[model samples]
Target: MRTVGNDLVRHQLHENRKWYLLLGALLIIFGVVLLASLGMATLSVVFLFGILMMVGGVLHIVAAFKIFDGGYRWLWAIFGVLYLIAGYYAFTAPVQTAVVLTSLLAIALIIGGIIRIINAFMFKPLPGWGWTLFSGLLTLLTGILIIASPTSPFWVLGMFLGIDILFQGINYLTLAAAIRNIPPSSADV
Candidate 1:
């Protein structure tokens, strides 16, 4: 008769939903804290930032897996490169990295606003045009604000980054948690 111990030798550990939840939460919080550091850092060891960046890139790539488009895959791939570059630069040249990120955010906002405006015009027999126009205006204002104070946009960056990561972590944890509530697979266990 095979004992439980014999089975234990071959049985794999069930997925630890809690562990992934903790990791996701930690990654999110850490990302924001690092952003708040604003090019100022004092790590006990070297390459910490780089390692964090690579992990961040991988997370983003994984997130992209749910998206349904070749374009999204490419986007995630490019995002991974950016993350690695950002992390490397943060560790090696924090000041420069800060400047670059600050500039990039401003540019991206401006372009996003322009795209919204273009999209707004493209819609005909305009349904919910008012909301779209309002959103566009808000986007423009955000872009302008960034342009006005690009040197120190940490407040905006920190707030937005924190909010985004917090929500993302919550969403992922929720999905994982839901798996537990569902019935286990019916396949012969």
Candidate 2:
């Protein structure tokens, strides 16, 4: 019962399975390394974030000039300046930046979790509502834990990032295996 699209997908997946395997292995290795050195990972992320913010700030400033006729040109310039200032602070005081970022992350997670929990209830008639509810609950709990834990600012972001990467690697590996096993199309016969 395979359609043409399915056959095409199978062919493409089989052809690219090696790449997926390589990417998954690399990600898994990175995740493990990050987890092993949470402090270094956190600092590394902060430094990278700082650099990105600086780049974004510069872009925004350039964009402000590009859109000189726009009514909100001043606003854009202001935001760009603000971003530059923030980026400078991030570079100068990464530890403080991490704390602020982690706090923001916790707040966001809390808000998102609440929204998801509410949505889950609204979608209770759907087939997998329980999973949504569970995920929301987990997110809410993690946020709370981050806020409550005194040491969270130092390691939470790194730990969560590492775990996410590890899981992503696992997902890619699983996908690679599945793709590798895709049945050959009739044309292959």
All models: lDDT?
0.63, 0.88
Clashes of each: 0, 0
Total clashes for model 1? 0
Give the least accurate 10-residue stretch of model 1, judged by summed lDDT.
Answer: 38-47
The TM-score values for the models, in the order shown, are 0.53, 0.83
Summarize candidate 2's per-residue lDDT along 46-150 as a digit string, tens digits.
887888888888888888889675767877888888888888988999999999999999999899899999999999999999999999999999899999998
Q: Which has the greatest lDDT?
A: 2
